[model samples]
Target: MRARAGGIAALVLGAVIWSAAPVSAAPAEGVQRTTIGAAERATALRFWTDARLRSARDLDAPPAASTPPAASAAGGRQAAPGTGEEVRVAPLPAPGAAAAAPALAASDPTPWTGGGLISTTAGKVFFQNAGGGTFACSATVANADNKSLVLTAGHCVVDAGTGEVYRNWVFIPGYANGDRPHGTFTASSLFHLDQYVATAGNANYDLAFARLAPLDGRSLGDTVGAQGIAFNAATGREVHSFGYGGSAAEGNGERLNHCSGVEYPDAGREGSTMWGIDCVQTGGSSGGAFLADFDAGSGGGYLVGDISVSAGSSEYHPVLGNEALDLYRQAGAA
Candidate 1:
């Protein structure tokens, strides 16, 4: 898997749900964490001023290299997309809808208006890369007992090449054209699957959870509300994916962009079972949220996945499984 924006490649692996058994060898290794001290948080806030954000709007990069339309591997010989394997009834009911989603004119897929929770829950993530330069990605606020959890792609938090997690992480919900309507929320810590930290190439575990620090004495959920997250969720859904990434169709990551499509299994690898959508979201959209039965009002829905990697401009995300559940539970507890 690779981020088209950065042109970075990572090793991807077949999907396998790891059990919740303790790793006795490393008792507390299931979830990896890194703290952002006060000094760093203060620096991050000033680093993302209005001017810097506006400059980023024009910085969307090129799409990642494209994969062969089809390739050979092992397990199911790449099931043809839309074989109904991607469509399944959600294991549990999705969150209640507040207002209907934006309506398209049938013939048009353009014109993506930031709607519902999509407006407040989904936002741009900024971090300092290992190179000391700034980069952006998409992310979403997720419901948690602590009211401080955020969901995003693993690579957005950790740089696979240097094996170092990026620093100065901050989330700005409803961010548009360098505007922070809800102000900025810096990350207290970041966590991801041990598998991703170890393999660095396994797209199967590319999702991550971030714990945000309180700003103005309020948790992230207290301000924007959070979306219900489902693990071991049913597949084959008609999903609406959101991101703030550079795209010719999307005003180059200045405004949020999204597309609706059915999820399908990976066509290039055997047993890789990663979920994919037919979208053209570019770099900054890497960590955006994928919502099932999204609502325009309330901004609440079942968070099934996030933008992880791209096959050309099309996007792929790790499906929520047992491993994801464990990560969520541990991150929320923290």
Candidate 2:
């Protein structure tokens, strides 16, 4: 259930519910998976032409004037103590020194001009909803054993309400204007937590991961360096979130923008325990990375959470706990 500030509608379109394709096997407990094979990947690549990619709508774009629904309470039991350990992975060496720019003000959505690994690792995600509506969001490559794992919001991968995953999913790293610097990578598999699936997008479990197929005999991490990821990390720290959010002022999703601020607990209409930052990023920003200890020069940091929802000037993200850690491990192994 990804939403934008200023009365935008949620990403899920309830008018036409659809079903997902058959999975390879039963998913592990508390997890859901959808596999994309070679044939499907080829079809997806053909479907997303340059024109169609440019015309795709932002998932968080404002719809007809109407009041959005209230967010449901966070459901599901808490993870047991010691269930998740703090983990970190160093990023691969990348060119470029840190940029000399002023710290972006809180709640300010500014275009990212610093050229670093982030320019290649964080990119736009395009897919069609279960109802065949073309839409776009944001995602980031994360360091993993397989070197092909991508992290995003759960709703960006599947509709929690219908349990139907999107179609023609593709990630274009270093996407800018209309250029794809690195080749597009298709999703080989998608993973989500059971709580988000069962509860219809509970914000507490809104995180998801994608296992991507290699491009031109190269893995995503090998092509574009990945950001280090962390689970069960301490909160209340400064965070830098990047995404290709659409807005008249931000090139309508053609360029990457970011927001930076200290994180706090969400206390707005969502009524969930997700973390919040003073950011004005809109709908397409969902599934963007919330990085901790980000270095402006190297454009690398530890992925702590992902964009989930936005209310007015504040944006929210799920707390990456044991369940999120488990999902990452599973995706990496896949």
Candidate 3:
């Protein structure tokens, strides 16, 4: 299936991007949820043995030539008709706010060699589509009930055209080439925005959350810990984006890559209000985390967004808004 809304795709500029249809005032507009059965969970676990892990294709590439073109490369829910282009302001979490300087303060994209909470919290997600092809995207653990929530991009969890949830879904936190430091956690169910699943290319609803089944009888949070998530967060602030995307410049996706920058209102397309950053991460990096006020030592921070779309060779966009926060609330309850 073709990618809808947000994800890693080669950016095509100067096109007349269409705006998203107006969404309802209801809190849960475009949200869809489903649970994975025991049998399916068992099958997914067995499917990702060492051999398959070595062979899974990186999902960072744009859709194949035969696939249909996506409606908009803009990633995020369409802003209301007359909202200004300025980045909206929101407050940061209170307790964790500290006086010490940030552990990672650089604005440049850097190779994450190792160490820190992010090492265990962020990892690569693997799934198989109806076409029988194995693919990958980035994902991270989030605090939730059952202590097994895995947050990622909607495009990674659901096929837009068929509305079929991707199968064989498993997350390998801190996954390095051939390394599964935290062991594999399979999903028991997945949740996404209804607008994303119903429409062909709605970036505003491009994110997703999954409730994972325990591996070796231990909950996911207990194993690697979970990151704090936020919605309707303050914009135009410094953010640290982490991913396992293929690096054309570096020539590998085996190691974690991160870029730090302040998010700004994207003005490239009309009818849509998306957040963008200046970073060069490419494919296979889709669904990676866009964290705010990240504490490198703690590996915990507010999950403001995830990798959604390419703005150019060096810039990326992630979705974070009211609808996205509502999706998280619904998923946590599920």
Candidate 4:
């Protein structure tokens, strides 16, 4: 995918330029957190009207380098076994929410008709880049101790080079067109690995977590359920990835689309390790969940990784290792 001017590309470019300055080696272990205060949260919620969402541009994915980096090891410490469990809750109805439609069979980018937890757990993320342009990406509600954490790509939340978190970040769960069935939740804080900040959005640490503020006195998890998350899990498993990516045939990021395929290890520029799958999801799909062991009946699965980069018909996910585990732990506790 080619990087565009207004969305994630600008952030990545900023990070790249910043990394050129004299600096120490990227941190071996550390979590960086950006808190959004109550005032900012309120402003975010008010800023994203239905009109703005419909007009928001897709957050473009960064260009994938053809040559893999020279580093051989995964960037962080070895990952432990998978952890966290799926937390399913009853779906809440939103006024004017779109009715559930049948999902299409397995395809590279097909409509998600499995009307279950995923219909509520997976949603669209909207925010403003440093340039003040509104952009949209995908996100998932992860089962966290706080019941408010959502997972997305790191680039969606922060500009690695400048260490600046995007403004007016909010998530629309079960979003279809302009309908927000579960209401909108503003981001209370953003969390990611320090390595991502130091390395200018390294693919190895492209994942991020956003702690959300409750909407109408209801927490996001209680409102729409949350998916299980796993780290250091085995690769090569058949995975289902969901996103609201825009394409000429894909409803232009207005609807949920999915791809099912087996994942394999792939190397990214700067030695960043990632998981690659055969998928055609394009821009605006960044930060969507890549689930393993997805059950069609329940629409639930373990979140093994997230959409980070796209090259041709393949999409890449960050390998959730020790650094990602620590970031999740911190976000859960926040």
lDDT of each: 0.66, 0.78, 0.66, 0.74
Once fitted onto the true fold, the runs of candidate 3 whose alpha carbons sit more than 4 angstroms away are: 1-29, 61-108, 248-251
Tell me how far the alpha carbon of residue 128 in candidate 1 is from the true structure, in angstroms, after superposition: 0.7
Question: Cα deviation in Å at residue 160, candidate 4?
Answer: 1.9
Q: Where does candidate 2 have its weakest 10-residue lDDT segment?
A: 62-71
The TM-score measured for candidate 2 stands at 0.88
lDDT of 1 by residue, 244-297 (tens): 766666666767777777778766644465787776576578778887766544
Candidate 4 accuracy as lDDT: 0.74
Per-residue alpha-carbon lDDT of candidate 3 for residues 156-258, written as tens digits (9 for 90 to 100): 8776655666778899988887699778888877888776655554555567888888788888877877777765667788888888866554335677777
lDDT of 4 by residue, 63-141 (tens): 4332223222344442222245333322223223344444444557887876777888899999986666788899999
- Rank by lDDT (best first): 2, 4, 1, 3
Measured with C-alpha atoms, the lDDT of residue 87 in candidate 4 is 32
Question: Candidate 2 overall Cα lDDT vs. reference?
Answer: 0.78
Residue pairs clashing in model 4 are: 15-161, 102-113, 103-113
Each candidate's number of clashing pairs is: 8, 2, 13, 3
TM-score of model 1 vs. true structure: 0.78
Candidate 2 local lDDT, 216-241, one digit each (tens): 99988888888899888888989999
